[model samples]
Target: MPQAAPMLRVENLAVTRGGLPVLEGLGFTLEAGQALVLRGPNGIGKTTLLRTLAGLQPALAGTISMPPETMAYAAHADGLKSTLTVTENLSFWAAVYGTGAIDAALDRMNLRQLADRPAHSLSAGQKRRLGLARLLVTGRPVWVLDEPTVSLDAASVALFAGAVRAHLAQGGAALMATHIDLGLSEATVLDLAPFKARPPELGGIAGSFDEAFA
Candidate 1:
């Protein structure tokens, strides 16, 4: 018998937003080639958990261990440069992540035709594809996606699912937060609300809409 490799491991994770604990002592492991979908009502900290895992937000307490250079995050904002052409944006991330498969990524997302167009000119769904294509270009083994299919059309959503399947085939892992079903057959689900708790003190900035939403 051999021990299994964990693409991502989270133990005793605790997170708070505006003095409310959204996650408490939540534990899970994502093995290579698997997908885990985080599900819950809005403001229950589904997005927060993803951001925390991406190291974008501070986790009050927890241990998150993952492989080096193997994790990629697809934030809700898409993170595309409005002024740059789609190809330019992908090229930039490729160099940053040191991945040499720009063409393959473009092809995967079906964005080759729009490669020369400015990101701002792309439709919402196209932008989502572009955002996802970045991960393909990076070739990271672990993906943390927040509302990945928010604006995608039916075909595009199916396309995204295909990309996910391909990624898994390559032994990658994914943790995604989505309201709609992603139609992924092999995915497992984790509900964040059960572990939800309010933070102790939201402080002066607590009155903002972010806290209100939380």
Candidate 2:
């Protein structure tokens, strides 16, 4: 019998930020219905790795294998329009992804009561909930999230966890960079410290003496 390939595969991937290598020689494979949590100290390139996997930035080297149009990314920012209503913001993403079911998405994120409220009026937690809701409408199989729980309260974190479980139950996968627990017991943890890039020689300094002193 033949086995299916992993939903997402990253091989010897390297990524750089600000023209300096931050992560290198990294690799991982995510099977469907599974979640992988990226764990490491601050400035260890977890976000950079997620961005590279999301195709938002070019990888310094290596390969990422996945079906086209199967990955969706959510960053720290909510990416909502202040002038748009909650439902409207979700609707916009649904339209862009050529999908529907905005109401269901809102409900999943516990935003049903705030559906008609303007995005600008929502609190930090509400905005984060809205951002997570956007993922539901994308219909993408793989989620690349950077700090998905950043501004969410305890109850909202539980809500987000439920959403993630539901996604996995439907054969979806997620790769997330988060400092706090997302309450997904089945999730695998990947500590990125081992993959940190070595600092450049000669101090890798730039700018003139005046700028340095300043």
State the C-alpha lDDT per candidate.
0.85, 0.89
- Top lDDT prediction, candidate number: 2
lDDT of 1 by residue, 38-149 (tens): 9999888888788888887677678988877778999888899999999999999999998766999999899999999999999999999999999998878999999999
Off by over 4 Å in 2: 1-3, 200-214
Q: Local error of candidate 2 at 190, Å?
A: 0.1
Model 1 per-residue lDDT at 52? 84
TM-score: which candidate is best? 2
What would the per-residue lDDT of candidate 2 be over residues 121-200, giving only the tens digit for each residue? 99999999999999999999999999999988999999999999999998999999999988899999999998887655
| Candidate 1 stretches greater than 4 Å from native | 1-3, 198-214
TM for every model, in the order presented, reads 0.89, 0.91
